[model samples]
Target: MAISSYDISSANTELARRAGYVDAQWALPAINAVELRRLQRRSNLHATLSTSLWLGLTVIAGFAVVATAWSWWSIPSVAVYAALYGGASDSRWHEMGHGTAFRSRRANDVIYYLACFMLLRGPTIWRWSHYRHHTDTIIKGHDAEIAFQRPPSVARTLWRFTHLQGGSELLLRLVRHAGGRLDDEAKELVPAHERRRVVLESRIMIGVLLIAVIATVVLRSAIPVVLIGGSTFLGGWLVVFFGITQHAGLQENVFDHRLNTRTVMMNPVFRFLYLNMNFHVEHHMFPSVPYYSLPSLHGEISSQLAPALPSTWAAYRQIIGAFRRQQVDPNYEIPLELPKIEGDARPVEIGAESWMRGPSGEVIVGLETSFGLGELRKVDIGRHSVVVGRTESGSLFACEGWCTHAKVHLGEGAVIGEEIECPKHNARFDCRTGEATRKPAKDGLTTYPVTVSKGRVSVHLVGIDSVGS
Candidate 1:
């Protein structure tokens, strides 16, 4: 029998790459610059409050479990703690992992590691893995995060709810990666630069686990491990409960997120636990937008997306039906009657058509409105592919178009305060001076002088002799 297309090393992987599926540009609904920027703003205050609340609840629940120990009341108490620890941490880790939860890099990092450990996910390894998940989405053979593999297994899916098998696999992988061992698929998924960090982080997680195990042995009690490593298995059902609803039985290997993702209407509690991730389609489409602002973002581009499922209950029915049919046919897809998006447009300014010679030594980039606040344009001039952006504070700046760390277009990224964040890796660059403000972006960008006068925006060109694509 042929290898499954879902296998990373299968021939279908090469086929997808050759067919332009891997790292292919996904379609986005157009939204004006100003509104998008408002939605994209990250706030430390918001993230801090949410983090504090979740932590506070978890702490209270933990104490309750201790207070009621050896009594039947401890069961409910532990359940609450597990839901907060094992369940809610999944969403927390996801938002923090994207660096969208907080404006402070330190805060995001702190939460990301905490959430990852709670869920038994290796911090560094899963960070890179998520990058692939976003890059390829549900593209078989390339994307590592496909929740339900083709010819879906109902039993395995049901088993995930117990978290017994799922959590063990994660723990086992952490051990392997900590020992400096990576499978072929993991090696290919993770960049060489990130592998060492992966190993280091794995060791850290394993060390923590070892300490918990030793405590369990020394104390002659399961309490130590129960509070630590055991929390993952106990609380993982919540993770599976919320996670299974996203992208399950949806279309795969598609460039349009609207076609492959769902937006389900959930109650306030579910929204809180999932961190507003029920806007899965919007989250996937505009990843730079923070969790706090997802609701507004949905309002901005809701018309362009499929109607939100009436409820999570509705989505589950659809998913189950699709899964059942796919079990037999293996190639079935849930028919998503997507609204026709006229123009199928993206919010971008093409360089070739937008640039002209100004009266002075500068090139007329566009009007002030053309390069509005929080807008990045890829301007190709002579030998340069320049990224021109207006920061949220209404200041204009220009720099190299591609990320120095990775060859992704900076125009597709979001401008955060004074720094421009890479869409692919969340690497940050100083918009004013072109300095690499954050990693995965080590090399600074080459900046150019930008000027605005009488509502006209222009850029000073450097040694331009020819214009070619």
Candidate 2:
């Protein structure tokens, strides 16, 4: 009746096998390195052409509206044109905001500043807040965009604050928030220098508003002034709507990419309108890739992009349905604890050094358990643990690490077909794909790549086929 001691070597071998351990000796299909490079070049070319076209159209439309100002019908015509222009310009701004609009950094900055002026938004403020959003896409309390859903008190406060201002006040608050000052509150994401810049920019905008007001009063025509102001405010609303629709109600998962974001498939026309931003999941997976190239990238990695929202129209239906039910959950919390790593696991070096090397030369030393970028840290597990390894057929899979949902490892968790029933929460992920098959975890566990080199074994540190390739 003596309990046997845990064998570290056996455990390591098992983990390796479950992780889709590939043999270096076997000639796996080599990725078309040349084609990947060509695709990247093509992506860049497409981005440049698309951005240029949008910019040209915006300039043309702006001039056309201004030139037609003498006509009686020009006002409404201009309003319609302005709205379309705003949409197209905002899409360009989004592209430039991600630093993907142009190959050159300085060129992107110039384009961003111009687009910001056209959209009546401060470039510095938008960029800082946006950079933070990218860093913490769905992390509540950290991600500014998705952090609004919270305790009743906070939500009520925000709702009241935003509601008090019909539109002008909202614009003012947004300006103040972007400028590193949130309605007498200190800035959360804006840097000190940037905050000063925002204040200066706000003063300039105020001066512009005063001049417009004076001109309207002197001319005894307030209609045009209202149109301009309303356009700016409406532009902000559209931006907010776009942001909320993408990941507002989705479950949050700090370590799991699948639950962290949602994807929306749309027809080519709608895709053009959205600038391919509907590919939210793919964008989250590969943020460096430009928006214009997202559709193509999604096609290339279709298998990994499963469980998507099917289409933009369907996603819109879900949004509307949730709103009708008043069951929108904006702030879904993600577990912060790292998954337990057993055996001789170590930390993965994930800086420039790791990124510079090819995947074949890279070794996955640990698992990434955080939303933002950085080195992957090692986790210490106590007794029971889930071991993910490869099969004899060279297939990858997962069982249970320690189900944070259930509080037990695979030993206690029941294995049912391709899923491991968490002894604690009943949460499951297809160990093969590391995707959540069920919820209550609303998240999935960490996955590592296993490969055998000669007689020794190694885990892939660098992500394979994660980039444009």
Candidate 3:
């Protein structure tokens, strides 16, 4: 019998790799660097206020559940509690994990760990898992986050509504990781050095759950467990309700999110609960864009992408039809009328036209008329790569193209307070001076002398020989 194609180690993995699906650069909508940078902005106040509201409501619901224990009212109270604790936590887990939720790295991590515990996910483990998901969305044998695998099982998909089966699987994985055993998929996704952190986090999570179990036993009531661990399953239905609409029955292993993802127009209430994830296609296409800015992003690129579904009801109807067909036809893919793509849509900007030689022997990077403030663009000169940016105050700066801590392209990161922040790890660097200003990035970047002159943004290689020597 052949191993499942969904397994990260299966032969299908190599086939996907050979077919150029694994970690392949996907097509992007025609949003320029300037507009994207504006959309990618993070707000600490937005994150804090939303988090406070969510947690505040959860606490109130929890109190209601406790006050009405074993009564008929407890039913509705518990449901509300679960939705707040488990359901809402899913979005928080995702956005925080993306590091686009909070301007402060610590703020993001604090909520990330809390949500991971609520969802029974390992912080370190799922962080890398989600990165892979973005790198290979819905690609068979590569994307670990593909919720609805092919030969779609209606039973499993419906079972997910209860959150029992899925939540239990996460719990089982938590236990296994606590025992210091890494699965094949985990091994494949997480770095070898980071595996130890997974074990440590798993053990910590299991210890907390064990305490909740012991408290339930000591109190001679299910209240303790119901309030703590049980909420994960109870509220999980909301997670499925919003999550299934994201990519279910859509085309997979494709470079275009418009083909593989769905965006739904939602009411203010649903948008609040799901954090604008209703713009699912937009989020997947531009992962760096914060959740709060997704709506604006959709508006910005709507003309270049697929139309958003009119409503969640409409999305479900379309998905159900696709699911029924897929049940019998494993190769079935929902037909999508993809927009015509003309130029390379990947974010990186390269080639001779992107730069020119200045009169004073400096290298012109981009035109001042086009390079808006906060815009980050990558320009390559032969083997050397440089990222050119115009700070918010209209100051021009240039530095080594990638993050010093990781190979992440600086052009993909956000500009905040004269600093460039890494999209992956939240590391910060002084954009003007190229100093490593934050953690996870100890080594500084090599800054180039940049000046805007005569409608041209140019960078003089001041240290071409002596700035460092």
**Cα error, candidate 1, residue 237 (Å):** 1.2
User: What are the per-residue Cα lDDT tens digits for candidate 2 across 249-349?
Assistant: 45532433445566777777656656788787666554545676677666765454335677666776765554434434433332222223222122111
- The RMSD of every model to the true structure, in order and in angstroms, is 2.7, 17.0, 3.9
Q: Estimate each model's TM-score.
A: 0.92, 0.54, 0.88
Global CA lDDT computed for model 3: 0.83
Q: Output the number of the lDDT-best candidate.
A: 1
The candidate with the higher TM-score, 1 or 2, is: 1
lDDT winner between 1 and 2, please give it.
1
User: Which residue runs does candidate 2 get wrong by more than 4 Å?
Assistant: 1-48, 59-79, 147-170, 174-186, 218-228, 235-237, 324-469
Candidate 2 TM-score versus the reference: 0.54
What's the C-alpha lDDT at position 343 in model 3?
67
Best by TM-score: 1
Query: Which ranges in model 1 have alpha carbons more than 4 Å from their true place?
Result: 1-3, 10-12, 345-353, 366-385, 392-395, 404-408, 439-443, 451-457
**What C-alpha lDDT, on a 0 to 100 scale, does residue 36 get in candidate 2?**
24
lDDT (Cα, 0-100) at 294 in candidate 1: 95
Error of 3 at 320 (Å): 0.5
- Supply the global lDDT for candidate 2: 0.48
Instruction: Report the error of model 1 at residue 460, Å.
Output: 2.4
